[model samples]
Target: MKKAFFIVSVLFYVNSYSQSESKKAKILEMISLTGVDKIGVQMMDNIMNSFRNRDNSIPDDFWIEVKKEVNSEELINLYVPIYDKYYTEEDLENLVKFYKSPTGKKVTSIMPQMMNESMEIGKKWGQELAQKVIQKLENRK
Candidate 1:
């Protein structure tokens, strides 16, 4: 009888402890703990700002041409609502936590610039490789 009573008591304690947790709050806590969403948001902001600052290096007329070809406004109209479905309260919390971390801050600050620079280098190398391959083919012909 004492063993049975002790078993029941343990079960009750476990049930109560678990019952006290709110699923929504638990999910939010998990998202804040993960911190990936924050990094992604920071990256997107950096990339958007980078494009916005194109200066005369990329002619604004090209943008006007592109906008005329593809109505970016219409595309965004169909696209923007997905954020409500995909970016939850949990994700926002996680993003906030990541934005506050030292490594996360460093990545948010410089990674986009590094990526842009590397892409330019990759394009340069690809052009060189294509020229070499073309030369080789012409020599053999």
Candidate 2:
């Protein structure tokens, strides 16, 4: 009886691990299909370029090394668990299908620009709010 139970437990554990791995693979593929990793790389490059433009004190070689250290594969691995936390394999499969469609392609093409513009808007908004707060403080004093 003990031997039978141990065999069954081992088989169950293997099957469960296999399913989990399969789901993780599917989610990773879905993330790839959405062009998310490409966008992340582009964002990193843009930030590095902006920093280089603003500050000549930092050498180009240093930024190059930083980019190498924070490469896309590592970022993707860090991101996979977050996706898995929020989405099931079925959700990922649906997302993969949507991303493969024409509208999805359009969204992917435009998303980076949209994000950049949104960031600019947020920064401007925050600066204005900070100015207002400073003015209020000055008036109070």
Candidate 3:
């Protein structure tokens, strides 16, 4: 009886592991099909570019090594758990389909520029709010 139970437990564990691996692979496929991983890689490149711009001491080889170490596969592995948490296999499939569409492709291409402009707008709004707060404080005093 004990041996039977052990066998059953082992089989269950193997099955569970297989399912997890299958899900992870599907999620990775969706990530690739949607160019989500490419976006992450591009963001990393932009960060590396900023470092290169801010300091001349770093060597070109340094950037190359950094890029190699922090490649798309690494980023995708890091993000797998987050994707798994938020999306099921069906959801990922739908997302992949959407991202392959023209509108989705446009959005993916423009996201970085949109983010930069949005940050500038947010900063200006924050500064305006801060000045108003300062004026109110002065008036109270």
Candidate 4:
């Protein structure tokens, strides 16, 4: 009986591990289909460009080497758990299907531009609100 229990436990552990790995792979596929991986790489490139702009002493070869060392998979792996926490396997599968469709492709293509414009608008709104707050505080004083 003890041996049978041990075998069952081992089988359960293996099955659970296999399911977890399968879920992780699905999450990765969804991320790739949505172009999030490319966005991460683009963000890295923008940060590197900022660093290069701030200090001209950094050699081009150094930046090149740094880029080579940077693995987008590591970033994607970080995303996997966060996605897994919020989305079920079925949700991820549906998302992957949507992202493969034409409408989804259009959305993926335009999202970065929309996000940038929204951020700019938000910044301007924030600055205006800050000015208003400052004026009100001065009047109160």
* Number of the top-ranking candidate, with TM-score as the measure: 4
TM-scores, one per candidate: 0.37, 0.74, 0.73, 0.91
lDDT for model 3 comes to 0.86
Model 3 regions more than 4 Å off: 1-11
Candidate 3 per-residue lDDT over residues 69-125, each given as its tens digit: 875787789989999999877787777788788987888778778989999999999
Q: Which pairs of residues collide in model 4?
A: none
Best-performing candidate as measured by lDDT = 4
* lDDT per residue as tens, model 4, 62-109: 999999999998999899999999998889888888888998899898
Q: What is the alpha-carbon lDDT of model 2 when measured against the actual structure? A: 0.88
lDDT values, one for every candidate: 0.61, 0.88, 0.86, 0.93
Question: Which is the winner by lDDT between candidate 1 and candidate 3?
Answer: 3
TM-score of 1: 0.37
Off by over 4 Å in 1: 1-92
Error of 3 at 64 (Å): 3.5
